[model samples]
Target: MDLQDQLKNLFPDHEPEESTDKIDAKPSYWLQDDPIICKYEKRKGKPITILEGYNGADSDLKKLAKDLKTFLGVGGSVKKETIIIQGDFRDKIMAFLKDNGFTVKRVGG
Candidate 1:
């Protein structure tokens, strides 16, 4: 006999309980009211994109930084809650953040 048949034979009156836990379809992070600032700058003669003004947990910010780096296929880091991307990708970054339910404010050219 199969396992299910054995179990049914052992517990004839027992009924399986339905699962009540709800799983979120997508992962969500703390979204702040203030828009995240996306700016461009040249540091040591290399163009870089900086995203700042995030008023959320540092871990979330770091996760965001890691996601951005992977999405853009570039190197970056998070320092003091600010995300520093290795290239000038303000427009793309802003669009990605907006799509992920974060307000983005583009600053400087």
Candidate 2:
């Protein structure tokens, strides 16, 4: 027998509780009404992408930053409620955020 068989034998009259979890659950990070600003800038002569205007918790913003970096296969960081990606990726970042249910606004070229 398997582990399930042994557990059933041990608790013959116990009923299994139904799980309330969802398989396709959305992201736990808070989504805001205001559009996230996706802007590009040349910081110290190096191109960088900045994402700001998030009204959620700092942890949520950090998680978003991490996700963005991972999804884009690039390096980035969360600073002062803003995400700083180490490249010009406005179009890709905006598309990714839109697919994930976020409203993104492109601020600059």
Residue-level lDDT of model 1, residues 1-66, one tens digit each, is: 999899999999999899999998545788889999999999999999999999898888888888
Per-model TM against the reference: 0.75, 0.75
- As a TM-score, model 2 comes out at 0.75
Lowest lDDT block of 10, candidate 2:
22-31
Estimate the Cα RMSD of every predicted model relative to the unseen true structure: 4.7, 3.7
> What are the per-residue Cα lDDT tens digits for candidate 2 across 49-91?
9998999988888888888898899998888889999999999
Q: Least accurate stretch of 10 residues (summed lDDT) in model 1?
A: 24-33
